[model samples]
Target chain A: MLLVAPAALYVLVFQIVPVVYGLILSFTEYTPLQRGAPTFVGLQNYAALVGDADFRGALWVTARYTLQVLPVTIAIALVLALLANRSFRGVGIFRSALYVPHIVSLTAVSMIWLWMYSQNGLINDILGTFNLSPQHWLNEPSSALNGVSVMRIWKALGSNMVLLLAGLQTIPKNLYEAASIDGAGRWHLFRHVTLPGLRPMLIYVIATDIIYLSQSFAEIFVLTSGGPLRSTTTVNYLIYTEAFEYSNMGSASAMAFVLFAFIAALTLIALRGGRER
Target chain B: MDRNERHTVYPANRRTFLKTSTAVLGSSLLVSACGGPSGGGSGADGDLTVWWPGVNPTEQDFVTEVLIPAFTEKTGRGAQATFIDWPDMSTRLNAGFSSGTGPDVYGHGPAAVADLVQYGRVEPLDDNLDQLDESDRKDLQTGLESGLVDDVHYLYPIASTGRQVAYNAEHFTDAGLDPDTPPTTFVSLREAAEQLAVHKSGKLQRAGIVFSAEAVGMQQAFTSILWAHGGEMFSEDGTSVLFTSDEGVEALTWYASLYQGDAPVDDNLGGTWDGLPPAQSPLATGDTSMTFTDPATLKQIMDAAPELDLRFMDVLAFDEGDEPAAFGGAATGLMINPDSQMQDDAWEFLKLTGSKDYNSMYAQEVGIVPVRASAIDTDYVKASPAMASAVANSEAFRSNPNIPAWTKIRDTLAQYLEQALNGQGTPKEALDAAAAEIEPILAEGR
Candidate 1:
C-alpha cells in the first residue's frame, strides 16, 4: 500500500484533478486571459457544440479518417508481418527496415509527406514522369482527408506489423505442424491456426489504433491546417484551435468531453466485439 | 582512546553543522520566496523583460547590443529581452500570465487588442501617450487610432505592414511585359497575370500570381483585395455583418476568378507562400510572378533569392484612378503588463521604443519599416523607396477589425474563401455563408 501511494498520488494530482477541473470548466465561460474566475453558464457551452457546424463537420471528418486509416493500416501491416515471419536470408535487416518509420517522429514523417504532396514536390514529379497531370494532394476538399489518411496509414504500419509479428511468434509451433500433418493447405493453416493465435493482439492493435487515429492533430496541422475548406479538421484539431487560438477554454473543454465520450463508446464496442470473437 | 574522543567531537560537530546549514538554507529560501526577479514577480528589481517574436538575428543584435545598453545607460536600469516564434507567442503569453510570471512588456498583433482589453491584462496607455511631445503625438495618433478600444489605448504601435503587389521583374521581362510598371488596377492586374502565366499541355508550369491557401493569418491577404475594391467586411458600427453586399460579392468573385484560370492563377496551382519558412516561398523559387505581401516578407524574398529582381506597388484597386489601399497596419506593438510591478521601468523602455531615433536604428537593423512618421526619413527608409512610400502614406493602409473574436472570424472567412476558390461554392455563396456565421459571433461579442 505504501509503495503504491506515491504513484497513486501522482496520478490523482496530475490526471484526475485536471480532468475534474476540465469537467467543471465545461459548464463555464473560462479563458486564462480573463481578469476574474471563470463564470459558470450551465449547459450553454455543451449546447453550443450541438449547433456548431464546424464541430459537427470535425466529428464527421474524424470518423471518416479513422474508418479509412484503421482497417487499411491493419490489413497492410498483417501482410507485411506475414512476409517478414517466413525464414529467409537477412530477415533481421528486413524487419529492421520495415520498423524504421515507427522510430521516426510523427511530425518529421508529416513534414516529409508535406513536401511529397506539394505542387512541385516529389509526388508530382513522379506523376509528371508518367505523363499524368499532378494531382492536388491536399488542396481539394474531396481528396484532402484521403491524402492525410494515406500518410497516417503508412506511419502506423510498422508498429502494427511488429505487434502482429510478436503475436505470430507466440503461437505454438506444434499447432501449425499438426495442422500441416493433417493435410491442411497453407491458406487453411493460416486461417485456422495463425488467425486464432493473433486475435488478442489484433484486438489490442485495433483498439489502440482507433484511439490514436481519432486523436490525429500534428499531421493535419502540418499538411493542411484543416483547410482547403475544413475537410481535414478533426475534432481534436478544432478543440486545439478553440483552446489555444481562440482562448475559449470552456468551449474547448466541452468539446474535449464530447470527444472523450465518443472514444469511450468506440472503445467499448471494440472490446465487446473482441470478446464475442 | 583518541579515536573515541574524535567520534564524540564528530557527533557534536555534526549537530552544530546541521544547525548552521538549516539556518542558512531557511534564510535563502525565505529570500527567494520573497524576492523574485526584483521589481518583477519573477525577475529582480530594476530589471525589465520584453518579449518579441520572430525577430531576425540582426534585429535581436540591435535590441541586445544597442537598445538594451542605451536603455540602461539612459535610465540606470538593466533590461533583458526574449524572442519567441510567432506561432508560439500567444501560448507563451497565456502560460506566462497564468503562471503570474509574464514579461513587463510584450508584443502582439493589433487584432489582439480587444481580447487583451477584455481580459484586462494590458495597461491602458492613454496616460503614457499624453506625456509624449506634440509632434510625436501627432505621428502616433493616426496609427494608434486602430489600437484604441473604448477610449482606452491598449496597444502602442511599434511597426506597420501594408499588403502591396510584388512582382518578379525578371518574370515580367521574360513574359514581354514592362519590368518597371506593375499592375495598379484589377483589369491590368488580371491582364498581367494572364500574360505572365506559363502553361504547358493544360498544366500551369508557372503561375502568374498565387494566393497563400495554408499560410498563417491568410485572411489578411483576401481582405486586402476585398478592401481594395471598396468592400467592407463589417458595418461601420460593427454591430452587423456587411460582407454579403455587392462590393463584397464583387471582391470575392474577382478573387475566385484568380483560381479559375480567368487570370494567371488556377485553383490547383498556388502554394502556401506567406507564414511559411522564407525558403519555401513560391516567389522565392520564381514559380509565381506576382503576389500581395508585406515589405518584411519581400525582404525575406530578397534574402531567399538575392539575384531575383523584385518590385512593390499598391494593391490593385477596382477603379484605375482610385488610390490602392493596402490591408495592413501596426501588426506588432508593445503593451505593458497591467500586473507588472516594474511599470515605471517598463514605461521608460516603451518610450524609447516609440522614439524616432530608436525606431530609425531598429528599422535599419530589422529591415522593418518604422511606425514613427518622423523615422520615415531615415537612411534605411530612403533606400527602400516603395516601403518608404507605403509608410509615408498611412492613409492608404487599413488594419483588420480589432475585436476579441477576430482570430475566429478570420479563420471562418478563410474557410469560405477556400470553399469558393476550390469550386465547392460560388463566391457569393461563400461570402454569404461567412456573413451568416460571423454576424452572430460579432453580435455575441457586442
Candidate 2:
C-alpha cells in the first residue's frame, strides 16, 4: 500500500479529481472571472449544446478528422515499421529520421507545415515547377481540414512506427519459419502469423491514437485556427475557445465531457473489435 | 509459504491496504479542498505584482530596465513585472484571477475591460483620473473615452491605435497614379487598385490592395469599412445590434467586392500578413501596392525598405466628403485588480505609464500610437510619417462596443463576414444571421 501511495496520489490529484470537478462544473453556470461558487443550472449547458450548430459541426469535424488521419497514419506507420524492422545498412539512421517529427514540438512542426502550405510556400513552389496552379491549402474550406490532417499524420507517424516496430520484433521467428515450412508464401505468413502477433500492440496504438487524434488542437490552432469556414474546428478547439475566449466554462466543460464520452465509446469499440479479431 | 498460504495472506493484507488507502485519500482530498492561501492577499512585503501583456523585446527592456527602476526610485515601492504574449493573456489572466494570485496591475486591450468590470475583477479608474491635471486629462481624452464601460473608466490607456491605408508610392507611380495624392475614399481606392493590380495567366501576381483577412483581422477590416459608411456595430447602450443596417450591407458589399470583381485587388483571400516579419510582408515583397494595416506594420515596412517610397493615408470613408473612420482605440492599457492590497501603488504605476514622458517613450520604442493627443508634437511622431498619420487621425478612430461579450460578438460576426467574403452568402444574409446570433449574447452580457 505504501509502495503504491505516490502513484495513486498522483492520479487522484491530477487526473481523477480534475475529471470529477469538470463533471460537476458541466452542470453549472460558471466563469472563472465570476466570484462565488458555480450556480447549478442542471443540463442547461448540455441542452444549449443540442441547439448549437457550431458544436454539432465541430463534432462532425472531429470524427472526420479522426477517421481521415487514423487509417492513413496507421497504414503508413506499419509500412515504415516493417521496413525498419529489417536488418539493413543504416537502419538506425532511417528509423531516427522517421521518428524526428514525433520528437519535434507539435507547435514547431505546425509552424513549418503552415509555411509549406502557404500560397508561395514549398508545396506551391513544387506545383508551380510542374506547371500546376498554386493551391490555397489552408485557406479553402475543402482543403483546410485535409491540410491539417497531412501535418498530423506526418507528426504521428514516428511514434506509431516505433511502437509497431517493437511489436514486429516480438513476433517469434519460429512462426514465420513454421509457416514457411508449410509452403506458405510471404503474404500468407504476414496475414496469419505476423498480423496476429502484432494485434495487441496495434490495438494499443489504435485506441491511444483515437484518443489523442480526437483531441487535436495545436495543429488546428496554428495552421487554420478553425477556418476558413471552421472546416477544421475540432471539438477540443471549440472547447478551448469556449472556455478561454468566451469564458463560458460551464458550456466548455459540458462539451469536454461529451468529447470524453465520445472518445471512450470509440476507444471501447476499437478495443472490442481488436479483441474479437 | 505455499501458494494457498500466500493467496490467503495477500487477500487479508489487500483488504487492510484498501481501507487505509481510502482513508488517506479522503483526508488528502479534504485537506486539499480546504487548504491554500485565501484569495486577495497582498504580495510579499507589499511589493506590487504587474502582468503586462505583449512580449516585445524593446517593450520588455524598457519596462524592466527603465520603467520599473524609475518607479522604485520615485516612490520607494518595488514592483515585479511579468510580460505575457497577447494570445496567451486571457488564459493566464483567467487562471490567475481564479486562483486569487493575479497581479496588482495587469494590462489588456480595451475590448476586455467590460468583461472584467462585469465580474468586478477591475478597479474603477474614475477616482484615479482626478489625479491628472485638466491639461493631461484633455490630452488623454481619446484613449480615456475608449476605456469606458457604461460611462465609467476602468483601464488607464497606454497606447492608441488606428487602421489606415498604407500604400507603396512606387507602386502608385508605376501604375500611372499620382504618388502625392493617395485615394481618400474606398471607391477611389478600389479604382486605384484596379490599375495597380498585376495579373498573369488568370493568377494575381500583384495585389493592388490587401486588407487583413485572418480571424480577428477580418472583423477589424469589416468594422473599419462599416464605420466609414456610418454604420455602427451596436447601439450606444450596447444592447442592440445595428451592423445589420443598410449602411452595413453596403460596407460589407464594398469589402466583399474587393475580391469579387474580374479585377480583384486582393489575391490571398484568407492569408495573414499582420504579424509577419517586416521583410516577409506583402508590401516589402512587392506583392501588394496598398495594404490596410496598423502603425507598427507600416513602420516596420518603412524601416525594412528604406529606399521604397512608403506612405500612409488618413482613415478613408466609403464616399468622398463623408466622415472617415477606422476600427481602433486603446490598443492596450493597464487595469488595477480590485483585490489588490496595493491599489495606490498600482494606480501610480498606471499614471506613470500614461504620463507624457513614459507614454511618448513607450510609443516611440514600441512603434505604437501614444495615448496622449499632444504626442503629435513628439519628435518620434514628427520623424515617422506613419505615426504622424495615426496621431493626426486619432479622433476618427472607433472600436468595438465595450461590452462583456464583445469578443464573442466580434468572432461571431467575423464568421459570417468570412462567409460573405467567400461568396457563401450575400452581405445582407450574413449580417442578418450574425445579428440574430449575436442578439442573445448581447442580452446575456447585459
Candidate 3:
C-alpha cells in the first residue's frame, strides 16, 4: 500500500483531477477570468457542441484519419520489422535510420514536413520531373486532409515498426525452427507463432496511436493550422483555439472533456477486441 | 533486442521502484520550477523585473545595451529583464497572473490587453497617466483606445504597423514599368502584376502581388477603404457583427479577382510572396512584384538580401470612384501588471518609454514610429524618405473598432476570407457565414 500510494497519488492529482475538472467545466459557463464561480448549464456545452459545424467537421476528419492511419502504420511497420529482424550487413545502420524521425522533435518534424508539403517545396520540385502540375499542398481544402495524413503516416510508421520489431524479437526462434522442421513455410510460421506472440504489444501500440492521433495538435498547428477553411481542424486544435486563443475556456474545457471521453472509449473498444489473454 | 530500451528502463538498474521514484522527482522539480523568488524581499532594494519576448539578435542587444542602461541611469534603479519565447510568454504571463508574482512591466501586444484587462491582471492607466504631457496623452488615447476594457485604458502605445504596398524596384525595371511610380490603386497594381509577373522552368520566380486570408479582417492597406466603402467590421457598442454588408462582399470579391488571373494563389501563399527566406516571405522570394507589408520588414529584406530592391506604395481605394484608406494599428504596448510590487516604478517606466527622449530612442533603435503625432516629424525620420512618408501618413491611421469579441471575429473572418479566396463560397456566402459565427460571440459579450 505504501509503495503504490505515491504513484496512485500522482495519478489522482495530475491525471484524474484534471479530467474531473474538465468534466465539471463541460457543464458550466466556466470562464478562466472568473475562477471561483461558474454558471452551471448542465450539458448545454455538449448540446452546443453538436451545433458547431467546426466540431462536426473535426469529428469527421478524425474518424477518417483513424481508419486510414491505423492499418497503414501497422502494415508498413510489420513489413519493415520482417526485413529488419533478419541478419543483414549494415542492418544496425538501417535500424537506426528508421527510428530517427520517431525520436525527432514533433515541431522539427512538422516544420520539415511543412516545407516538403509546401508548393515550390520538395514534393512539388520532385513532381516537376514527371511534368506534374504543382498542387497546392497545404493551401487548398480538397487535398489538405491527404497532405496532413501523409505526414502523419510518415511520422507514426517508424514507432509502430520499432514496436513490431521488438515484438518480433520476443517470438522464440526455436518455434520457427520447429515449424521449419515440420516443413512449415515462413507464412505458416508467422501465422501460427508471430501473430499470437505480438498481439499484446500490437494492442498497446494501436491504442496509443489512436489516443495520440485523435488528440493531434502539433502537426496541425505547424502545417495547416486547422485551415484552408479548417479542413485540418482536430479536436485538440479546437480545444486550443477555444481556450487559449479565444479565451472561451468554458467551451474549450467542455470540448476537451468530450474529446477525452471519445478517445478513451475508442481506445478501450479497440483494445478490448484484441487478444486479451 | 534493444540496448536503448534497456537504458531507458533502468538508468541505475532499479525496476518499478526506480521508474516511480523518477516520476516523483520530476513532479517535485516541476513544483520548485514554478515557485517564486530566491532573492529574498519584494525587490524594494531597487530591482525592476521586466518580461520580454524574442525578436532579432540586435533586439536582445538593444535591451542589454540601450533600454536597460538608459532606464537605470534615469531612475537609479537596477532593472532586470528576462527574455522568453513569444508563445511561452503568454503561458508565463498567465501563470504569473494566477500566482501573483508577475513582472512589474510586460512587453505585450495590444490585442492582449482586452483579455488581460478582463482577467483583472492589467491595471487601467486612465488615472496613472494624467501626469504625462497632453500631446503624449492624446497619442496614447488615439493609439490605445482599442485596447480598452469597459471604456478604460489598459495599454500604452509603443509601436505601429500598417499594410503599405512594397514593390521590388528591380522587378519594376525588368518588367518595363516605372520603378518610381508603382501602382496606388487595385487596377494599376493588377496591370503592373500582369506585366511584371514571371514563371520559370516549372518554377515561379516572381509575382505581381500577394493576398492573405487576413485580407478582409486586417486589410491594412485596405481597412480604411473597407470602412469608407460602407462596410464596418463591427458595431459602435463593440457588441455586434456588422461586416456582412453588400459592400464587404464586394470588397472581398474585388480582392479575390486580383489573384484569379493576374496572380496565382501559389504566388501569394505565405512566405512565397513575402520575399522571406527559406520559410518564404512573399516579397522576399520575389514571388510578388509588390506586397502590402509592414515597413518593419524592410530591414529584414535589406539584411536577408542586400542586393534586393523593393519599393513601398500606398493602398488604393475600392475603385477609382472611391477614396483610398490604409489599415493601421500599433504593434504592442507596455502595461502595469496589477499584481506587480512597484506601482510607482512601473508607472515611471511607462512614462519614460512614451517620453520624446525614449520615444525617439525606441524609434531609432527599434525602427518603430512613435505613438505621438509630434514624434512623427522628428529629424531622425526625415533622414530617411520612406520613414518620412509613413510618419506623415500615421495621422490618417485608424484602429479596429474596440469590440469585445474582435479576436474571435478575426478568426471567423480569416476562415471566411480563405473560403472566398478558394472559391469554396461566394463573397456573400462567406460574409454571411462569418457574421453568423460572430453574432453569438457578440451576443455573449453583451
User: lDDT of each structure?
Assistant: 0.79, 0.88, 0.69
Tell me candidate 3's TM-score on chain B: 0.80
In the range B1-446, model 2's lDDT, one tens digit per residue, is 88888778678678876786567666654443332333353664677888999999999999998899989988799888899999999998887877777899999998898999998889999987987789989888878888899999998899988899999998888889998988988889889999999988887888889877777889999888888988888899988999999989999998898888677778777777543468767888788899999887789889998888889998999897678999887899899988888878888999998899998999888888888889999999999999899999998998677998788988999999999998888999999999999999999988
Across B1-446, the per-residue lDDT of candidate 1 in tens digits comes to 69888778668666765575456555543442232322223354757888887757887888889989999999898888999888788888876776567889998888778887877778998887888878888886656866877667888887877777788998999889998777778768878888988888776878788766663435776677667777777876677877788877777777778777434364442246332566667787767888767787887777777788887865567666555766777868888888787777788888887677887778777878688776666778887755676677666778787776788888888777777776667888988888888888898887
Model 1 sits at a Cα RMSD from the real structure of 8.4
Interface RMSD for model 3 amounts to 7.6
Quote model 2's TM-score for chain B.
0.93
Top-DockQ candidate index: 2
Q: Which stretches of candidate 1 lie over 4 Å from their true place?
A: B1-46, B55-62, B138-143, B215-218, B261-264, B268-271, B274-277, B364-367, B374-376, B382-395
- Candidate 3, residues B332-417, lDDT tens digits: the string is 67887765667787778777777777777777776665566666568867654445556666645566655555567667677776
Error of 3 at B289 (Å): 1.2
How well does candidate 1 match the true structure in TM-score terms?
0.89
Winner on lDDT between 2 and 3 is 2
| Model 3 lDDT tens row, A153-214 | 88887888889899989988898899899999978988988888889888988899998889
Which 10 consecutive residues of model 1 chain B have the lowest summed lDDT?
Answer: B32-41
